[model samples]
Target: MIVHSFPPIIDSGCRMLVLGSMPGAASLQAHRYYWNPRNYMWRILYALFGDGREPDEAYEERLAFALRSGVALWDTIASCERKGSLDSEIRQAIPNDIPGLLADYPNVRAIVCNGSKSLAELTKHFGDHPEVRSRELIRMPSTSPIPTRDYRGLEDRLEVWKKLLEL
Candidate 1:
């Protein structure tokens, strides 16, 4: 199966860009980033910036919240062939035009990769680009529901994700 990333959720005021490797099956079907309820991305964001409540269920509201927090969302892979939602399954990945987006949005001062895969892809494709190198680059643990040895609990992940507040 082939998957394609959505257009960036961004604005001129955005100072941080969050990049995922690609949308999972649920996100693709729902036409929204991190649509999977099990994903920790929304929860983490809400906890960090919202009024200590659960994230709004509406997609537009979530985007608005991110933008208001000076954050943007995108993916490293524009398109790829994959059997499942796992980044490990992706093949022949084509990177998104990150440099072009950075050129257009000069206010974006930091790029945050949601997982190892996103960081690896970003480095592979844009490591040398001035637009990428000149800004802060961060790699956070994957917010996917899948468990990892290092980041098994939401609190553990949240602890690291809290760094975004400092940026």
Candidate 2:
């Protein structure tokens, strides 16, 4: 079973949380979030915060930059059975304790779901709960290299993700 080993990079200062469906193969192999060179999650963040300098090249620095900027990274699935890294292949998925984290981080003003699966999981866990439904849920395109008909490249996807760090 593949499990999310990356702990939530959240603190009381966290104003936004970006949730991915789960770590892709490269990320899980490297024990880092968004490890794939083609993944634009880091590149988008760098553009928004680091002035377009290379950020993912330094693993720890990238994470620090996220936390320092009041953004946190995590996955919706705590563990799952999947032959590959694709979310479509995921099975027996166990969701993370998003409600608990939301309660712990009262400073969180918004939740930016990085993909459709992440948003669906949150809706599954907290759809009827007033506390969770109250917050703004900004669903952005997945940063995975997996291409969809709507978004072809990072630039197309980056424009949609800009609101995640637009504090």
Candidate 3:
């Protein structure tokens, strides 16, 4: 089935752009990013910022915190055909116009990919785009509940994500 991406959550003050490969079925259905209960993205964000608000708060609070923290959420694939919510099953992916996004948000100091799929998509298309290459690019583990041998646990992933918050 074809999956469409959400419009980015960004503002003029955004200094970090967080990119995912695509929204999962749960996120799309909820019309919210990282809505899965098992997903660690929200937990990771709260830990990084010490936001005080619980991770499982209302969607509006999460969105407000991200915007206030100068972090923008978006996805690398504008649209794609994917089975279920697995990034591995994505096909016919159309890349988002990231260069244009960079131009539009001049304060962005870093571009952080939420997982391998998003990193590959960005590198394949915009790796050499002057504006893209100019920013600090980082690749972090996916926040999906699926276990990966490399990441021992949420702690392991948070260690990597801690550096993202500092950037």
Cα-lDDT of candidate 3: 0.90
Model 1: worst 10 consecutive residues (lDDT sum): 49-58
Ranking by lDDT: 1, 3, 2
lDDT of 1 by residue, 6-86 (tens): 999999999999999999999999999999989999999999989678999789999999999898999999999998799
What digit string (tens of lDDT, one per residue) describes model 3 on residues 22-88?
Answer: 9999999998999988888888888887554567478988888888888899999999999899998
Backbone clashes in candidate 2 total: 0
* Alpha carbon deviation, residue 55, candidate 3 (Å): 1.9
Worst 10 residues of 2 by lDDT: 1-10
Best by lDDT: 1
| Deviation in Å, model 2, residue 30 alpha carbon | 1.2
> What stretches of model 3 exceed 4 Å from their correct place?
51-53
**TM-scores of the candidates in the order shown:** 0.98, 0.93, 0.96
Give the Cα RMSD of candidate 2: 1.5
Candidate 1, superposed: residue stretches over 4 Å from native: none
